[model samples]
Target: MEVMQYAEDALTINLGNEVDEKINRQLVILKAAIEKLEIEGITDIVLSYTSLIVYFDVQKTNIEKLKESLSTLDLSDLTDSTYSYKVIKIPVCYGGKFGPDLDSFKADGLEPEDVIARHSEKEYLVYMLGFMPGFPFLGGLDESLYKARLDSPRTKIPAGSVGIGGQQTGMYPFDSPGGWNLLGRTPIPLYDSSRESAILYEAGDRIIYTSIDEDEYYRIQEAYEKGQYTVDIEYRGEENGA
Candidate 1:
């Protein structure tokens, strides 16, 4: 691991140069460890794919002191099962209006139905949330379903729109311009300003997609809009996504 002063009062602890589960696991554990230390002056801890930025209050601590404190952290024991994880089920309606770009995969010689099936077959890992608020950058997409970005990005992709770009697949948490190939949309709200926690998923979580028909999609959408639907979440060893 490498520690560098990111700002006048912030430090970045880098675990690796690439995105991986082990790297994210280290980040989660390190964040917990730092919080457990109760290091005075620490104002905030922000996590990324493979690093975390620690913001501090200069009045209570200096760079050297914080570095000294971090240098002693015991991370060698951070193993596969050391940290907990959640698996979230995201129901999606592919093709037709929901997945306008579902036909894009045809260039790779795969049908939309097969693409949806393969896409939902595996559990994807949440590497980080970026590009927008509550937008999760997910990993573990089926190699066969890989596709390039649209010739032109859409002016506004509706929230919960699941799209694929290169080797990655993620959802647009808000209605925003995006270039990813949109294959489907989910009824669940990824970000709700009214909720105590606005963002649904975080890094280190896992996600699994399930296919739903148009009728089912509308049913979920209606219930969700009426605040009558509550997405269930499992404990450790469960969910992912945006």
Candidate 2:
């Protein structure tokens, strides 16, 4: 890991070269250090897919103090209590109205079952939350299922739609326009502005998708809309990316 001090109030830490679950786990380290300083002014702390960017107020905290604070941060020392990450199992229904790109994906040398099997076989890590509120940027897709995004992005992708664009896969949390090739739809409502924690998944959590039929999806959808259902969660250990 390499740490670079920028200007008088910013420090950038490089964990590695790529974005994945492994990199996302490093957020715990940053949160732990910041909590210790109890600094009066923290402008912003942004965690990208692979690096940690911390912005502080020069008026309240100096570069030397910031550097000293970062030096005490040991990635391995972060307590499990300091970070709250959970593994969530998202139930999705694939094919037919849910996945219009089914046949197209099959043509990419993948059978419909092969597609589902490949997608659900491993637990993915939530690398970051972006694109839309509560929508997680997940890592851990079976390379066999890799496919490019549609040449033309859909004018409107329904909320709860699951998609694969490039080497990654993600879920749509709101009814937004997007370009990812749609593969399925989940009944889970991932974001609710009224709730205290509007976003269901955050960076560093694990995610798994379980296949469900149309009938189950409808039942869950109705219950979810009423705020009576809770999404199921499943956990799996970390694996090194090849």
Candidate 3:
């Protein structure tokens, strides 16, 4: 890990340029260390694919004090929690009305069958939730499916639109313009601020996409709207305490 001081008010810890399970493990440990401090001045701990940016209050926590506090943390002793995380199986309908970029994917040598097969073959990790609320930034996309974003972003990408951009894939929680290649969508609501826990998924959870046909899509959509869909989940606990 490389630490860079910025503006004497924030600390950006760079976890290097690669994405791996180790980095994810470190994030969980580092976050616990920060939370242990119970520092009154810390504003937020923003996590990205390979970095943790900690914002601090200048009036309460100075750069030296923050750095010293961080130094006392023994990262070697830090470990993930033993609590189990549920593996959610999300049903999605690829192509057709759900995916606007179906033609473009076909143009890029990706048939609908191939897309669904590759997409559903792997279990993705929710590396970090960002860009949109409850919108998980998933990793482990098959390299073959990697494609760049559109030259021109759409004026409006409907909520639940699942898209792929380069090596990453995510769903649009709400209607918004984006350049990621649309592959399909799910009926599940990614973000709902009204509920006690509005976000459906969180970091450290495992996600699996189950392919469904267009008819099933509508069926699921109707059920979801009527609060009839029951999200299926499986849990796997971590070995060590958080």
Candidate 4:
């Protein structure tokens, strides 16, 4: 790991240069370790694909002291520790009105059912939440279903609209302009301003998709609007790997 001064009161820890599970695992462990320190000056810890930025209060801690403390952390201690991960199951309705871009894949000789099956079969990892609040940058999409983003981005994509851009797939948490190819939409709200914590998923969490018909989608959507639907989530203990 390499450490560098990022800002007047922040330090960037470079765990690796690639976006691999091993590097992410190390970043998560390190972030957890640092938080456990309850480091007096630490204001926030931001994690990325392969690095972490630790912000501190200059008045309470100095760069040298923070570096000294971090240097002593043993990464091996977390080898046996199991991180409890939430497996979020998102319900989606592919094709038709929900996914106008269904023909885009069909042009490539892919059946609509094949597209849905390919997209939902695997559990994807949440690399980070960015671009928009509660918008999860998920990894692990099937390469066969990969498609490029729209040359012209949409002026406004509805909330819960699931889309594929390049090799990645994600859902828009709110109404916003986006360039991703819309495949379908989910009924669950990824971000709710009324909640104490607005965002749903966080980095290191895993997400899985469940196929739903139009009827089921509307049912879930109505229930969610009425605050009666509970999102299906499972605790996949410890390690994120299968």
Sorted by lDDT (best first), the order is 4, 1, 3, 2
Regions more than 4 Å wrong, model 1: 237-242
Over 4 Å off, model 4: 239-242
Which has the greatest TM-score? Answer: 4
Task: Score each candidate by Cα lDDT.
Answer: 0.85, 0.78, 0.80, 0.85
Question: Per model, how many backbone clashes are there?
Answer: 8, 0, 1, 1
Per-candidate TM-scores read 0.91, 0.82, 0.85, 0.92
Instruction: Give me candidate 1's TM-score against the actual structure.
Output: 0.91
Q: For candidate 4, write residues 135-203 as lDDT tens digits.
A: 888899998888999999999988999999998899999999999999899988889887555776788
Residue pairs in clash, model 3: 81-242
For model 1, name the residue pairs that clash.
86-238, 86-239, 87-238, 87-239, 88-239, 206-239, 206-240, 207-240
RMSD of each: 3.2, 3.6, 2.9, 1.8
Query: What is the per-residue lDDT of model 2 for residues 156-242, given as tens digits with 9 covering 90 to 100?
Result: 999989999888999899898888878899987788777766776767788989898999999999998898887775443433221
Give per-residue lDDT, candidate 1, residue 24.
80
- Which has the higher TM-score value, candidate number 2 or candidate number 3? 3
* Model 4 lDDT on a 0 to 1 scale: 0.85
Instruction: Name the regions of candidate 3 deviating beyond 4 angstroms.
Output: 7-9, 79-84, 240-242
